[model samples]
Target chain A: MSLYRPPRTQSSEITPREVYLSRRSFMAGTAAGLAFAASGTALAAPLAATPSAYKVADKLTPKQDVTTYNNFYEFGVNKSDPAANSGDFKPTPWAIEVGGLVAKPQVIDLEKIMTEIPMEERVYRMRCVETWSMVIPWIGFPLSALLDRVEPLGSAKYVAFETVVRPAEMPGQSGFFQPLNWPYVEGLRLDEARHPLTILATGLYGETLPNQNGAPIRLVVPWKYGFKGVKSIVKITLTEKEPPTTWKNSGPSEYGFYANVNPAVDHPRWSQATERRIGEGDGLFGGRRVDTLPFNGYADEVAGLYAGMDLKKFY
Target chain B: MALPALPARLKPASVWALYALGLMPGLYAFYLGIYGGLGADPVREFEHLLGTWALRFLCAGLVITPIRDLLSVNLIAYRRALGLIAFYYVLAHFTVYLTLDRGLILTSILGDILKRPYIMLGMVGLLILIPLALTSNRWSIRRLGSRWNSLHKLAYPLLLAALLHYVLSLKSITLEPAIYIAVVTVLLGYRLVRPKLMERRRARRVTATR
Candidate 1:
């Protein structure tokens, strides 16, 4: 045996020692059910991504914050409730039924979708309708990829997505006063659905998606508010008419169908001109607010798609 | 079901203990903020924590009257302490929102209060509490005398405003806030009807003697 052993692996050697150690601790902590306790620092992993023009230049929100601070109402109403209550939620063995106005309607298993579609890491700015924002690195393939597989017919003018409604799994749905309707529904115009930026994200930060952040798979519509990206999806329907979205159905005046991220159109209750960026602390103040962006800073790529339509009226 | 009152000698010690207990939530929140443990948004968490404790303490203060009337438990000695603690929490909540949330931006703070109904309601609640907090001491009590009771009756409106502020603050109405409203309404209802019931009982006693 040589006096000095060669490096275990070239890639491992290239990674900073602290990063490697932290990543190991993160994985170990996650396995040990100590992930929530591991704050934002230890969970920061160096995710690998093929550089794309679509990627945002902003820093990624800390993985711990992004995972813990979620608005999956199926789990609960509070931001922290989802992470706390979603421990028992089972996301595996998932199948999404793609039907209605499609040439070939089928229920595809999540595993098949994961293996068949080529996953790409895309950093996108997610703006909540509640006036909070985060830059997330989502790993998944485009919604177009799935739509193409389904072969949507000419009659299909809109795409609707429905989340899984399991009272046993989702505590919010079981409560006496349900938060919105169960099996939360969201929709997108066919063109918007097929846009390259609309992705069906399966993972984030080089790891499988956590339950609170919509495990197994979820939609990622960068241009619209975060709620437009429905989570834990179990159904995708192509329709000739506009679909009834949960929020829109609940409050027609407040939540419109085309819930685009527009600073000009405030959410009746609060101003949308500014957004608090999570994970970016401002000393004693929790998070600092920056001016909200039109189309959540993806206007250049998606603005043309809404051409001739009055955004304020549509919004 | 009658509950025993605390011994006269233990009153001071008990009040001090309750005061120390009331500080726990704020202290815990501060520790969390310093240690990077307040989740994603520490300021928001801190603000919410302080606001919640303020509401809880207010509810506790209001329930003292009902507890005495119904259960015959006399907790009058601690009522002022509870109210003072609530005032402290409300002050902390307002300070955090102004300094940390708004970064002491005067224009924005004033604008928010003017424009937002919920913020306005919260300010009104705080304004109601100011006089009560000021008059909590023995000197002010002696100066005001009977007028002190009338001045402190503002607690009812303050509680209502605080609850309304909380309900409207949320994007959607949920069970938690609704329950708080119900509890406060019940307590107020008890206060409204108790004196009449006591007068009837006194009349019955006099008639029995006759």
Candidate 2:
């Protein structure tokens, strides 16, 4: 019973009662009118946004592909499983527990976080480790905005993320032979988390996120592989040591801790030199393969963060 | 061991029925691919479906001999049909890879086959299956006579190459491919051990008669 209770935090006093109440009402007003559609349904309410410098110039992947085709293995392993299997996933009334090595670790309600942070539309090229890529126009605020509110201590070197593991709702977790270890975990260096390009995306295509595409809230680290952007995150832990990621723990040789999109370092199974654009093709057989870019074409903005470290070794 | 006689009525009717049934998966794959039913990356999905069915049909073809020997089920009439369907699937799989996936770019396709081990293994499987498919008809069987049996034994090696190709192509070791491999092993093991068991049975029969 205690585990279900929200964790108490020192930052509870930071928000004055009046301000908190007013912001809650504002969020409720804006989000209440939006239709919570199932997978493949159009999201009608357009989130307010300003154009971001991080936006990629490439053509946006078809919204259908973005929502229908996903790797949310918590739902299922097939690319279509997330869309087909996630209809019953309950995302509302969710809270993200931001704890570990922080001055004011707090459980931020999803509604409060949405209203407090201003949304920006960033068109980022999402590169999967499987050599498929998509350009998505994600609607959300920068991860740094949330991290700034949490106030990470100096000792915190890495920021860890954990996805929700509701076996009853997410059928993949309940299956006899699970594809991945439960509670899919991912991590990023403290600096990566604070980067302006890293975002806690709430929606895409001018609509609240579809359940298949990590409804309610998810992370989007543009320069890293898609798996690094963990979905439906329930916990954020700031730690001194690197966190154990699900893929890295599953296959250390194939999935690295720093899963930066580097075409030079190929995956153990396939070459990362080229990627098939998911929605570029005709209905049947027209997709084209393009050469993959270094750091997924975001090298200028995020490459310096790696500095002198060998990318191949880290990858 | 004596070969069980097939039911007299089960010849041409069952052959055509099984042939139509075997094509259902490919037809369904096409239906899904063309109608927006296949999810994002339809080409990849279509390609995977074709490859998967090819491997499955190959396994099915290989399993027939063992089923006949052990269970006295005379499915020998449909074995050739199953193999031809598998070959058709393999061709379709390669066509998807070459035309749709790599866009018929000779250099890229050749380069991928040369560089990537999985593609190389897949090609090896295709190469081994070509003669078996071409000679699948009665004319070649009649012309070659006894040598036909020796030539068609190539299916054994073809299955090995196809199974390995399937295993190597995956992103990670998942249960699906592991199950395929396990099934393939059991089928191949039965084929390997059947001859010895049959020979021992024949020896025992001769001694008892003497």
TM-score of chain A of each: 0.87, 0.86
Considering chain A alone, report the TM-score of candidate 2 relative to the true chain A: 0.86
Binned by DockQ into CAPRI classes (incorrect, acceptable, medium, high), candidate 2 is medium
- Model 1 chain A poorest ten-residue lDDT run: A1-10
C-alpha lDDT score of every prediction, in listed order: 0.83, 0.84
TM-score for all predictions? 0.89, 0.87
- Model 1 agreement with the true structure over A180-282: per-residue lDDT tens digits: 8887999999999999999998878766678888877899998899888899999999999999998888888888999999988877666777787889874
Q: List, residue by residue over A151-207, the lDDT tens digit for candidate 2.
A: 999999999999998998998898677768989999999999999889999888666
Model 2, residue pairs in steric clash: A281-A287
TM-score for chain B considered on its own, for each of the candidates: 0.94, 0.93
What C-alpha root-mean-square deviation, in Å, does candidate 2 show against the real structure? 9.1
Taking all chains together, the TM-score of candidate 2 against the true structure is: 0.87
Judge candidate 1 against the unseen true structure and give its global Cα lDDT, from 0 to 1.
0.83
